[model samples]
Target: MEVKKNPNIAVSRNSSLYFAIGLNVMLLITWLSLEYKTFDKPDVLLENLTLIEEFEEDIPITDLNMPPPPPPPPVLSAPETITIVEDAKEIEETVIESSETSQDEKIEERIVEVSDVDVEDIDEEVSVPFSVVEEVPVFPGCDGNSNDELKACFSKKINDHIIKNFRYPQAALELGIYGKVFVLFTIDKDGNVANIKSRGPDKMLEKEAERIIGLLPQMKPGYQRGRPVSVPYSIPINFQIQN
Candidate 1:
């Protein structure tokens, strides 16, 4: 057989066919590589992620049924400063004065308390004479009926009587008692003695002096500015037991 030659045409057809097949084969390999790589991707995470952790410590927890401990007591603080105080002392003295007249009166006035069992009844009685009061000076005897005259006469009469009968109390003499006894009396316009009151160391002495003064005779009446008037008077009786 004799060969007919189209060498360039055959070469063109075979080159085109070979080039298309190579391109398709290359595209298929790239797709298969991409799928396998995506399917086998590595699991990864970024750094600085805030991680949370849960733990169970061995510390014991109180039971709901158990009682709790008591709270602590409050504390007391010391004072910043202390103060001290001192008391002042005082001195005193007392003095007392006693009256001899008051002592005598108290001694005579005090009542003696005797037991009834120790007391005895007596049937006998004793009668004693009235105490003798010396006569007092006679007043004016209404000679000068003036009130001043009467007052002067009455005062003189009473004073004289008091002087004559004045005696020292035996107890007072023994106890060395000495004092002035006060006497009060009132004179009337008729020169007569009105009210007479006497206080002395002894009641017996006081009464005896009063009785003698009462016995004085009528005197010239007392006078106020030359007119008859009544007046009150006070006198002191001084007795001396020492001779």
Candidate 2:
């Protein structure tokens, strides 16, 4: 059999309400005690307040008698003297030569004799594109080749030349400078490499690339329409320092 416990001995739900009421009562009592203990504030005196202005002493005016500044000096004008000359010679009129003279007249004839020039001796500058050339240049060791084969052989020979003469500059190698140097050179009508220009990361590398390109052996000149023409070629030389 289960025995039921007494509910009054346990905490009731309305106990919180009693605690709240007790807290409110304590606060009310503290406020009442504070109000009753406070004395009446002293009565504010209603005396009439008048603004008293400070007396400013009268200052005496001083009369300063200063002499007037002296007048500026007068400017003197220079005298204009009119001197008349007794005798003056009149200028004579000059006579100009007339340009309407006859052809038979004895006038000085300036002869500007120009000699006949022979333009045939002057070689006309001609440039032909290497890609569309009638006959491509042949490398020194690449003779006995057709046009297309000659182009391929020439490219191979140029690369081989660069490789054979490639030298990294000491300063560049020490500084770990490595880059591709574009070498532009012109193959003249005489088959000699000329007008070499190179651009690279450093001056030393550019100079080295220029030197290699300048060492290219003379080849047979490319011809277009039965006349030799200059051919511009560009090649890139890579300068790398092997670790």
Candidate 3:
């Protein structure tokens, strides 16, 4: 005989459905517990506000003792008799001379000679750029037959001068500052250097560069249109720190 009992008496038959229902109930309880919140009610005491009544006091008006306005000024008396006098003095008529000249008036012709007039010679200081000047400024001890040779010699001399006079600022060296400073100077018509300026990474370097350029000896002024003029020149000086 087969071992077949009643289906209602099978424990495992309804076990899966009971387990699913229990799981759903447990999930609903857990969701409710997580979403539920309770807030604490603060205790507040109510007090009655009492208003105090203010009384207004009356002020007595005092009259100021001002003197009455001064009496009107006395009227001036006029004479009853009027006298008529005749003035017999004659006034000379003023004559105004006309500034305009007529056609018949002869204008004096004066001859002006160029030699008789004073001619003042004014030396105007003119500035010219180095690159476009007809004759570049000549450095001392730099003699060349051609302009190109002169320029080369000038540049060489400038480099030599920078090397000779260049002294790195002790503060800059101590601060580990190194850069290239651009120096600009003007050679005036008197063949003297003026307006020496420099721009560098630091003021110390710029000051040192300016000092070096200022030490340059007098150079021959540049010429333009057969006239001496101030020439502006710019050069870069490198301040390097060697290891």
Give the Cα lDDT of each candidate: 0.60, 0.88, 0.91
lDDT of 1 by residue, 14-100 (tens): 988899999999999999988774456788886897978988889888767868889999898987886554457454668777655
Please state the error at residue 18 of candidate 3 in Å. 8.9
For 1-243, candidate 3 gives per-residue lDDT tens digits of 888799888999999999999999999999999999999999898899898999999898999999999999999999799866558866678999999999999989999776766889999989988878889999999998877887899899999999988888888899999999999999999799999988989999999999988989998888999999999999999999999
Which prediction has the highest lDDT against the true structure? Answer: 3
Clashing pairs in 3: none
Clashing pairs in 2: none
Candidate 2 lDDT by residue in tens digits, 31-79? 9988886568999999998999999999999999999999999999999
Please list the residue runs of candidate 3 whose C-alpha ends up more than 4 Å from where it truly belongs after superposition. Answer: 1-31, 43-122
Worst 10 residues of 2 by lDDT: 83-92
Q: TM per model? A: 0.32, 0.52, 0.59
Candidate 1 segments exceeding 4 Å error? 1-138, 141-159, 167-177, 225-227
Model 2 TM-score relative to the real fold = 0.52
Query: Model 1 misses residue 52 by how many Å?
Result: 74
> Cα lDDT of model 2 overall?
0.88
